[model samples]
Target: MNIIIDTVVKEYDNVTIDIDGYVPIDIKLVDSKGNPPLYWRVGDGSKSLLELAVLPENGFLSAITLVMMDANSIHKVGNNQVELSCEESGLPIVNLDLWKDSANNDFSQRFIDNFNCDMQVYISEDTILIKIIESDNVNWIHCGGGFYLGLNEEKNITHLLINSLTQVDITNFTESVC
Candidate 1:
């Protein structure tokens, strides 16, 4: 693919987006073994895994989240003179789930700025659509709020945008959780 997360970050070793409830979501763009700290956390300072709390903010959300992580695992978004000068590459999509109170779930609805594949191609020409790879968890459902006895298959939080669309399935991830 011609995309990997975004553009400014032209290279990376690996990329992993950890979506957990406690932290909500933590995007780690591991560029080098000891690239240096670009964010903050309570841990050692060996320097890998850039954690961008909020830079590529997205106002859109849906049952599925769209991101392009290529073989290089490096991607950048935006071309604005001002925006291009930013340090962070991307942020949690619709991650406004926090610092704004919680009670809803959302996913891809519109082309979100700052946090999508290079808009120049994906949204502009509308060519080379991003593909959903296997075993890549890409969905999150808040399921109204409150609590539950256990994570039912329906709300086990095990969903992915398969076939390029948001769909639920009974996978090992769900089975182990429930």
Candidate 2:
């Protein structure tokens, strides 16, 4: 099994990470020691977890919301991209860009330029995970006079974890998010 981890730093404390291969079996939000954060409960990936007012650490704001994808649900669109869709409606929820360029990949950079947050990736023999860290410094643009959640930032944050039961699970198990 092989694993690869990538990190990206963007403006306004926004970050996005793209993990290739592997599939996830479970997801959770834990502290630096891997213990569950106080007053936080795991939820299905249908809504925003940040709205619950999960407090910040030190002076920075952060949240971990997991999107569990059945391994059979992912389809490769190209050599550098994968698409995950809603099983019931077949609507796309996330598009992973894995484009590899010279020296640097444009996928993470493009996400940073677009979202402006810090991102981390965790890949193991059987799981590919993405962690997005956002801070209060981010400038969110509210559209239609606050009719929407706001733009210029990736809100309703969710981490896409591939289910390990899929045929593609091959990496050695590794514990992330501690």
Candidate 3:
């Protein structure tokens, strides 16, 4: 199996991951002064994958480790949200604006309660799109997509698309090999 990670940024960065089977993943968080402790949770509707806790220090930054087994799980940690999907071919797209709505009246408290960490406030109505595609002959088990900000205002809305291919030997479950 293979894993792919993708990131996108408008005013802030957004990341997505794709994986096959169950795998352990490690994430890091920085302990910024005057900020609340970071926390993470994975859930599908009411089903949560983890309990809230302070991220552990792993070397330079705090880390959040998880062994993922489901593809439909959504992870919300600090100010970031992640989702996984399985796709064979073609381009996969993701939008980065679904995180928070600063224009809403309860945005402040809601954002604070969810992330439990300090976050920079940026009030701009912008949206970013990302796409991912397979690029090599090898069969890929994971894929990701994201975008980043640009220098110029005209170029500020950036789009990033990635294609990944793996060389892992694939096995068919139905065919019994001797």
Score each candidate by Cα lDDT.
Answer: 0.22, 0.26, 0.23
- Segments of candidate 3 deviating more than 4 angstroms: 1-22, 29-38, 45-61, 72-178
Instruction: Please provide, for model 3 over 56-93, each residue's C-alpha lDDT reduced to its tens digit, 9 standing for 90 to 100.
Output: 12111122233321322222223221122322322212
**Superior candidate under lDDT, 2 versus 3:** 2
Q: Which structure is stronger by lDDT: 1 or 3?
A: 3
- Candidate 3 displacement at residue 75 in angstroms: 15
**Span of ten consecutive residues with least summed lDDT in model 2:** 142-151
Clashes of 2: 11
TM-score of each prediction: 0.20, 0.24, 0.21
Q: How many angstroms is residue 12 displaced in model 3 relative to the true structure, after the best TM-score fit?
A: 16
lDDT of 2 by residue, 54-111 (tens): 2222211223333333233233321212233321211111112211221252333322
Quote model 2's TM-score: 0.24
Of 1 and 2, the candidate ahead on TM-score is 2
Query: Predictions ranked by TM-score, top down?
Result: 2, 3, 1
Each candidate's number of clashing pairs is 11, 11, 4
Task: Please write out the lDDT profile of model 1 over residues 15-132, one tens digit for every residue.
Answer: 4433332232233432223212122111111211112222223322112222222223322223211111123222213233232322222232112222322221111111112222
